[model samples]
Target: MKIAIIGTGYVGIVSGTCFSEFGHEVVCIDKDAAKVAALCQGQIPIYEPGLADMVAKNMTGGRLHFTTELSEAVPEADAVFIAVGTPSSRRGDGYADLSYLYQAAKDLAPHLTGYTVVVDKSTVPVGTARQVARVISETNPTADFDMASNPEFLREGAAINDFMRPDRVVIGVENEKAATVLREIYNALYLIETPIVITGIETAELIKYAANAFLAVKISFINEMANICEAVGADAIALAKGIGLDGRIGKKFLHPGPGYGGSCFPKDTVALLRTVQEHGVSARIVEAAVEVNAAQKARMVKKIRDALGGSETGLTIGVLGLTFKPETDDMRESPALTILPALIEKGAKVVAHDPQGMREAAKLLPDSVIYVENPYEVCLGADAIILMTEWNQYRALDFKRVLATMNKPVFVDLRNVYEPNKMRAIGFEYHGNGRGHEKR
Candidate 1:
């Protein structure tokens, strides 16, 4: 299979590299010459676990290539994947911005030589595949291509494994030819008997949005439960465990935290809501989840302020993590973005550290935050320590050193990574979410 992927963002780069690893010839195209050059030299722009090594191996094996020109790879390709970004609209309408995606289709129209399958690998709204097809046909009426929808479900920090061992593959096509090409591209997964759901193009597009919205709802539901546990003098961890043990409600997104924040959940949930409302349907449950998620982050600010003796004014607070979750450096919609700024506005001096997100975090966070080189350095002379993201290093911190270094030994565990009883025994004032009954 010869695959040409447009856009070198997270989805495009990962999908293209993984396709090459499957023994398919792949060329990832980006308009940015510098990014293409960096990729060609084995210099990856993003920090995904094991991605750089895989890319290097495939490139060295003559299976993967990167270029800024579409003509370099599009003409002879069996399938051209549009994996560009579909970020939330800047107009505040909660719709996905599809200008980049549509432009990619127009650009690839003239280069289509034979019966090529044009696959939409980006998470997009319903009917986007049809719109892309219309755009390509309008641009080049003589082009021979079929539109297909193959949305990606890659979780950041675990994208490689998710691509290779996906729970299932959902492909949308109008005819057998397009379906056959996509299936052949994923023949490796087919050989392993990976379940593939072939559906209409619209259903495939809606599936991605529905799946993300449901996960967001689950996360918001757990956070709401955590709040109830705090109010009723119960433990959310035990509560989650009790309910999760039920065969019907397995334990996946039930872990309580500040809120759900990442590229997918926040953006996709709003997009889903927008799409539903646009169709004259109501999505009240998803709407409430969005409201609750916003409130959860605000509540975390209050939780920290309460732990700081009713105020954050003039206090030095240490944050252990900045990225939304660990193992990736994506700060888009991270709770730290909201929580830290609110605390800073209340006159708190903030210090933060993340294993891989400091460079990116510095760009999104307020300039007042002091970025530290070491994890423990964030605790130096701080009034309190807030365990924001559960990075591996923060899990087993030298509490003795932290207790000694802090001006006030106030520990606020937002992620509930530590036991409330054990932290209290460690001679520091501890505050954990949904563990009101654990206070001694």
Candidate 2:
């Protein structure tokens, strides 16, 4: 199968590479010439685990290619995938910027020589499939291609693995022809019993956002429980474990932390809420989830302030982990973004460290933040240390060394990495989410 992937961003690049790996001859087309040039040199623009190796291998094997021109790829391909970014609008409405999608439809529609499958691999609104169909029809009135919505659900850190073996492959098509092409394209996964959910175009679009929003709601719910646990001296971990063991409540996305961040959850949840509002119906649960997530970030700042005995003046705060989650270099909407500035505004100097997110974080954080190489480097001469993201490296630290280096050995464990009693026993003041301080 020859596939043309429009927009070589995260979804497009990863999907193109993975599709090529699945034995399809794929040409990834991006409007950005510099990005296309970088891809030509085997330079992966994004930092996703195991993606570079796959991209290089597929490109080397002649199964994958990259280009800046749509005409070069679209005319020769059997399928065209719109994997472009659909970032949220400023009004917090569920509307996405469809300029690129529309442009790609117009540009490719005129060049469609045969029956081509136009798939929407981007996370779009419910009626976007109809809009895409309209654009393609207007561009080439007699074009024989059919539009299908196949939304992607790949997580940033574990994208490759998820793509290689997804739980399900959803296909929303208007006809048997479009469905057959998608079914054949995903034939590799079909053998593994990966359920192929067949639905309407609108349902498929909403499914992606609904799935993300539900997960976000789960995390926010646990965080809300963590707040209640703090007031009642109950342990959130124990409660999560108890609830998670139930067959109905499976043990995923139950960990109580600062809040859900990165690119998907926040954006998807807000988009879903906007969709609901546009229909004049209130999505109360989702609205509360969004509100609680915002409050959770603010609460983390207060925890740090209280740990430092209420004054941040002339203090050096050590922040460990700048990425939203570990194993990926994505810092969009990371809790550290919310907490770091508050510390800086209160006259405290922040030194932060992450295994791979420093470059992205530098852009978002203030110039006052000293980007350190090691976790211990940030802890040196710090008044208090905060674990913003739970990177595995920070899990096991030389507590003695950290305590020796810090002016005040106050540890604000936002991810609940350490036992409060254990930290207290080790002669360090410890504070964790939903866990009160150990009595002196």
Per-residue lDDT tens digits for candidate 1, residues 1-440, read 99999999999999999999999999999999989989999999999999999999999999999999999999999999999999999999999999999999999999999889999999999989999999999999999999999999999999999999999999999999999999999999999999999999999999999999899999999999999999888999999999999889889999999999999999999999898888999999999999999999999999999889899999999999999999999999999999999999999999999999999999988899999999899999999999999999898888988899999989999999998778878888999888868653
Give the CA lDDT, 0 to 100, for residue 197 in model 1: 99
Instruction: Report RMSD for candidate 1.
Output: 0.8
Could you give the C-alpha RMSD of every candidate to the true structure, in order shown?
A: 0.8, 1.4
| Clash pairs detected, candidate 1 | none
Error of 1 at 168 (Å): 0.6
Cα lDDT computed for each candidate against the true fold: 0.94, 0.89
> What is the alpha-carbon lDDT of model 1 when measured against the actual structure?
0.94
lDDT value, residue 304 of candidate 1: 95
